[model samples]
Target: MNTLIKQFTLFVVLTLFTGMAAVAQQSDYQIQQDFRTEYNELLERIDQATTTEALEEIEEAINDLEDEYEQHADLIDASSNPDSFDGAISTLRQTHASAVESISTIEDLNDQIEDLETEMEGVKSRLDQLSDERTTLQQQIDASTENEARQASLIRQYRENIEERNLFVSNFLGELLSKYQSMDSAQQQEISEAAGRLEENPIDVIKNVINEYINMMDQSSALMAPDYVSMKAQHGYFVEVWDSIGEQLVNTFAPENPAQTQEEVDQLLTAWQSSITNNLWGSIRTSFSENGVELAEFNSSEEFFNALNSYLDGSIETSVERNSEEDYDVYREFNNFWSNTVKAEWGEMFIEGDILSQSQISAIDMKLDDWRDEAMPTSNLTFILLIVSIAVIIGLIVLLLTRKSGESKA
Candidate 1:
């Protein structure tokens, strides 16, 4: 009976042990199955992710999976039946990291593009406001025709506003140029396409600004009484602005045809220069004619200076030979011409526009000063000659009177 009891006890113990082993084995199999299922789901999610946020969430889930199955790594590897859990996890981590990095780069590029667009919009808004103010000031100038002072004031204000607007545009272009040069090819292309989509592309804005300046120049050239001083300032400002962006404009279009783009830019600059020359010379000719100084049409600055020098030399020689009071009036007239017309009206224009060198201006000034010295003598030689003649006449009268007295005494 004791032997029978021992056998029953052995059977019961063996049965409980087998059942427990089966349960533990089943639990490990479930764990492996759960890990695989989650891992596959994560792979799909990583493949489909298009944003950093989505990829980050998937990465976190992957980390959790790794942590949860860390203790059962060997069992999970065995359950894989030819694939190790660790190898798969490594691949998943690599893929997840790559996805996250790619998505993050894309997001960063998109953010940069957005910032550029916002800045462009702000520039457009400011330009629109300036345009409105300029229009109002122009209207005020036109309506104040009866009040010359008011008209002049309004015109000055209008010009100041234009200068401000142009300066802002130049600075904006400079900043954009720096930004464009700093960008990678991909970012550059993206920005170029985006700018092209706007109502006015940045290239078109540059072109339009140049065209507007040219138009203003043409208007000034056409005027019977052109404001040469103001026109000179405006032209100088336009040149400065163009110099800042002209290279960028050419580079922007260089991908298509570099030579043609360069030719077009050169043509625009030449037109600007020609307009300035025509306007200044036309006004000078009119002023010379009004002042009784005959000035012929000149094709070049050298020709103009030669003709002026010759005329001044001839006038000086004539004044020296005549030595009359009329020459003094001529001196005053020529001095006024030099001071008000040559120096005041056109000197700055010629120098700033690079039409004439400083040495050329200095040479002209020296010639004018020499002519002034010759035309108006400081010694008063005419007065001295008159006094000597009077003394001779008085001496002759005294001798005649003394001879008459001797005859009366005889």
Candidate 2:
């Protein structure tokens, strides 16, 4: 009876051990299934993630799963059938990494775009200030009397403001161009939409810049004492800006008609040149008349130069007859008008502004030199007359002395 009790106890013990083993095996299988289910869910989340925050959350979950299943990894892999647990883990890690990279790129692009928008706002503000200041300075110039020093000072400030504004524009454009070239089509479209929200489209900004430059040119043309040096410098800067950014702007906004845009710009520049030329000619004509040099109506610069040459010829002929101090004063006045007013002011401006050629200026200078040589008072004739009179007086004294001596001797 004791032997029978020992066998039953052994059977019961064996049964308990068997049951525990089965339960533990089932538990491991359950853990493996749970791991796969959670990993697949995280993968789905990664696929659906749109933003950096979402991607980060997914990456954290993936790392957590890796840590939780680290010890059971071997078991999970052993139990896995068609799709290996190791493969799924690798896929989740790789997919999560890819999603994070993509999200980071997008976020970086957005940050850059925001920075550009902020910069654009500052640029706009600065440009507005410059415009206001220029207008005020122009008003001051117009309202003030004809004080050359004050006018020159105001004009210098105006030009400095213009240069500052243009430099800002150029720097902004360079940054924008770099960003634009780096972007893909979708990114470029996004930027374009952002620019629209700001109500300052890049193309429109370029157009406004061109318009402002033209308006400034018009104002210069209307000014009584136009700053030709400033105008030429500004024009050159405008050309450089246009060359750098013009094509890109057209490509971004009006890709279909680049040639038309170029043609329009050309026409505007030509018009500006014509307006300045006409105004300068009108001023020259008025100045000539004020100086008592009557010039007929001239159709072109060539015709005006011809009339000028004729006047110089007539003046040179008259210069030879100048003998008195009053005559010298007249010559000095004409010479001062030519040197100070015409050559120093207008002629230099004409050459610098490309209104006249160097050769033409050289010809005019030669004629002026000839006129000066002939008009300047000389002592040669007076000295000759004085020497002849002295010789005649000495001869008469000698004759009287000789006649007295002869009479005394008789």
Candidate 3:
């Protein structure tokens, strides 16, 4: 009994000591593997902040860390007990693989983002250039439109100046020509030779000729009383009156008197030509004197056009005189008839046989009526013939039908 008790107590003591040792152990198959798994997970998290500053850094880290984790995972096995250590290691390895693969995918996405940003910057530059070009083209279009309007205005002014200067030259020279022509043939030949020698500086010639006329006017005025009209005085008087009537015309086109630009002079001349042709000289001059230049009131634009047409027609008439006299006579008779008819019609329509305020449209209506009258004779004849032809056709059809019906009945 004493030996069995001692053996049982020894066995119990050994078992308790073994249990305590097992509980105190830092590394046993299951415990060592749990510590390793926890330590590896902490290491993976710490290493996740890659020190290398590139997308490729994560790729390298994934390969290196995944290999290390798998090797560590192999240390725990299916043969191990308690903690099912092999399963834990397998789960940890799979997590490591997933993390590594996720990092690689993220790195690829980041690289693609960088390439797209770079391409976007290039596109932005081209868009900026297109915007700049569009602005430049719009500015050029505006500048061109302004330049064209300015050029048109300048051209119009230039034309008017030329006309005025030419008119002044023509009148002054015409006076001299008339005087020279009155002389004997031998003296006239001498005058012509002298004129041919004068150089054609239009401005110089204009100044010289106008000054001469001015001097001639001064001498004549000095010789005569204000009310007295001598032969020389009469000529000067008419020139003075004409000059008085020309003030508005002169002022309308008068550039700075001390020095006129070439373009201005040219345009003044053009205005003068139109003014002279339209017989608006006195009216234009009076308006200019009153400091009121309403060119629209003159409405001489039509008169100017009509004068040009008349001059052209006169030349054509001369040519027509050489052709068949019969045709010429026919044309003449037609012209006379048309003119008389128009004058008679216009007088009756607008005047109310005397005086009436006619509208612009009413005037046009009057002209249209006259034009219609011209065509009425021919139209009336055609209308009559058409009615007769239609009636004859209808009569023939009726006769034929009646005759056929009568024969059929017989």
Candidate 4:
């Protein structure tokens, strides 16, 4: 029994010793595996680092791993074979040596890289300057190649424009001279004054002269138109001017404002209306004398009407024997003569010539329409005045007759 008990105790001690050895060996292998993995990872970090700063960061991690490896040195040495610990220690020593060697060369390598970059920048700047100079030289060559053709084209255009202007001036000046001879004193003075302002530009001077002359002829023609015969006679006076000028004045220059042009001509006609009145009234008096009805000399429109009324009354009383006041209505006859002969002659002129275009005819019609519209209000006021005058005159006659009858009776 004693011997069996001894054998049991010995077996138990051997089993415990073998287990402790196996545990220590396993711990050492684990540490070796961990160290190998960490060392490999740090080496990979160092190889991947591009900058000196990044390489220094890996160097810090390596120093930390090395401190931890030394702290576990006794356990590794006691628990495992010397070969296992030696392999890890040698790997750490070689890695430290390589890191120190790499750190020593870093500053010089960075300086060399910076110098190369500076040299490349200078080369790039010089190449850019040379490229700019080449571009400038090419541009100068192209401009020199095109200069002769561009100059020739400009000269050709200049000559053509000068020739066209000369031809226009020549034709216009000829027509202007011929028309100047036929213009009245007022028209000549107006054109000469306008032309004097444009001495620097002969073309414009002649254009203004032609424009003024045409405006006068148009006004004269319009004012004389209600009497077609008189209008035709007036137009005939300027027929040569019309033939020479043709539609050149209107066709060459666009009227700035057609309505304004008509207004100006109307104003001019008003200023020159004395000549028209003399022409018309002189013709009337001459015809009346030819008809053997002697008229009293009259200057005013009112006196002229009174002389006409006296002629009509005397002529009617001698020729037609009438008993009633209505039969001897001399005023009505005067009104008829004024409305049918004089007013009708003064109203609208019928345009019937090739010299005036449709546009000009329409403009004339518009002017006449405007004048008639403006005159309508005045004509109504004039009629009202005539009525009031007649009523006052009748009342005065009645009052005089009543006073005369009362005095006779007394």
Candidate 5:
């Protein structure tokens, strides 16, 4: 029994030594079996590391139980006090707590570093966005600059057009001023007033005003057409009367002077208008009164009437005055009586001779002198105004469209 007790005590000593080896190897199960034997040694060594560096190193060693703890976070939690290394583990808790307090002071600084890195990523993203914005802005600016160039070109064209139109204004205004000087001063003032309420183009307005005057004069010139018509009617009356008289006289007096060719007679008749208007005032008055009316008065000589009457009786004496509008009063009286009388005489001659068939003579058309000269016309100003107004409206719309596009980009 004594030998057995000695053997058992030896076995216990060996087991204790083996447990010490396991403790060095960080074996929790082995350390548990013989903790009583190794506990004092662990405590002595733990106190030996008293300096801060030595404590810190020991704390590193203990806290660097990182690998072990990682494998057993739940097993080694503060509430996970293992019965095997309870006292040693308890001693380590105090040291680790002190280290934790020191590390807590650096936590805010470390978090700040992480936040700064995150903010840098955000800043990079914003920088990228800014770069894109800058590129888009550059494109917009380039387009706007091109538009400015186009607008500048338009301005240059406008200035050039202004210069060109000034020439028209120069002539129109000069003529108008000269005309105005001759007119009543009140008339001139009225014209100036008429020019005031205008904007588009003053030169064009002046030109349009002059064109209106010219057109008005052209329209009024139609009234002179009556003189031509009356003269023409008298021409017809003289032609029918003289042709009949000449054919009868020639046939009776000179039967062998066979009817002249159509061409020769046409030539002879062509000269009649100039002939009689120049002469034959008395005969014309007699013929006109016989038809229906009378001449107003005789400003012309009897020689004039004789020459014309002699021509109607088949004599051609070309010596005659060129009666101008200076002779208007004399001609006007003759024309006033002849206007009705000659037309009536020509109608009677047509009825008696039946030179032209009724259908042909009756179909003869009479047109107003306005066809030859208009009374009032559709004005050119209206068309020009329409074109200019459309251009201005289109230009304004394009400008507005470009502005809206630019504003949206901004």
Candidate 6:
């Protein structure tokens, strides 16, 4: 009975020891897995770090991971699994490499930021120099009262300097605004202040530009005064200015301009409509009335176009015979103004159903086509004359040669 009891006690004791041993081995395996998991997470964070502070945080985590890894190193080394030991060591090396790469990235970003700061400083310096030069030039321009040419030269220089400075401001504002969101609070505030100092409101710029165009057009009209040839050239110049101003208006509201807004764009469009109606259309109508094509005489668009074509084709033909180069130029200017400007207005009116119907528009288009076809014959008139002149010269030469041959035979 005593022998059986001793055997049973030994069996129970051995079983408990075996269970404890298994639990300890499982616990070690869990600890190693946790370390690897933590190390992997640190590596991931290192790769994603954008700032010095973030990198520093990742560095601390890496260090902690290393300490934990060291604590388990002996256990991992003693474990029967060679793969577990190798994996831990390999992960440690990978974490170090990740940290080094993160540091390099941070350094590179810092260098880029420094370079940008330097470039911006240079721009500000140039801007200041230009402003000083402009001030000095303006004083010179103001002092030179009697010498018109010298004053003009000084004014031109002043204007050029101002334009350069303004261009710098525009470009700087654009660049700063684009990078603003990526900036820290302090950097954003600094850039915002700088941009505020330099930025011109796009709406104001557009208004000033349009006003300048209007003034230029008015001046050109005055220069046209009584000279028909100069009127044509000036009209052509005015058209170019008008088109260029329209394009400038579009660019002013472009996405790149920081001050562009929907309300401002609407105001600009309204201003354009008013300017076209009062300034451009009014001026053109006045000019036509002065030229003897009474616009009021034609109630219908058909009558209006017919009278215009007749004046251009028939009435102008006799005048062209006595016309000089200047007259031809004036005539060409009138032609273009009629085709480009007047026709544009007419088309708009047609679309609005204000003056012409769809049928009327089509009729006028056909009439204009027929007129062009008729004008084709007139276009070839010069060529026809050249051919006739050549034929006459050849006949005269042949007659002279025949007479000389007959005389020689005699």
RMSD of each: 11.3, 10.6, 31.9, 34.2, 45.2, 13.4
lDDT of 4 by residue, 209-314 (tens): 3343343333321122223224233433334443444333322222344355434434443433444444545555654455444788865445655675565546
Reference-based TM-score of each model: 0.69, 0.64, 0.24, 0.25, 0.18, 0.35
Report clash pairs, candidate 5.
280-304, 280-305, 281-305
Off by over 4 Å in 6: 1-76, 79-87, 162-410
Instruction: Return the top candidate by TM-score.
Output: 1
Q: Over the full model, what C-alpha lDDT does candidate 3 score relative to the true structure?
A: 0.42
Error of 4 at 40 (Å): 6.7
Off by over 4 Å in 1: 1-18, 50-59, 79-93, 181-187, 193-199, 218-280, 284-294, 299-349, 378-410
Could you give candidate 2's per-residue lDDT for residues 264-382 as a string of tens digits? 77566566556545555666677777777666676466877787788778777877776445545665776687678777866655665555567877887898888767766667556
Best-fitting candidate, scored by lDDT: 1
lDDT of 1 by residue, 201-278 (tens): 455555556565566667531233235544555556555655665555445434466467656766776786677676
| Ranking of models by TM-score | 1, 2, 6, 4, 3, 5
Whole-model Cα lDDT per candidate?
A: 0.71, 0.70, 0.42, 0.49, 0.42, 0.53
**Model 6 clash tally, residue pairs:** 0
Q: How many backbone clashes does candidate 5 have?
A: 3
Pull out the clashing pairs in model 2.
none
Which ranges in model 4 have alpha carbons more than 4 Å from their true place?
Answer: 1-10, 29-54, 75-97, 100-123, 130-410
Q: Candidate 4 at 238: error in angstroms?
A: 90
Please write out the lDDT profile of model 5 over residues 1-410, one tens digit for every residue.
99999999999999999999977656553333334334344445456653445555666565544333445433334333443344455566674556555444345434534553454344435434533443444344445555876645544443333233334334434443443334444433333333323232222332243332232223221112222233334346435544434333233223344265333444555654444343334444455556443435442434423333342222111111322333333334434443454445444443333322344333321111111112112243357679999999999999999999999999
Q: Give a tens-digit lDDT track for model 6, residues 290-351.
A: 65434444534356556555655553464445444444444555555556654563455333
* Model 3 / residue 390 / CA error / Å: 59
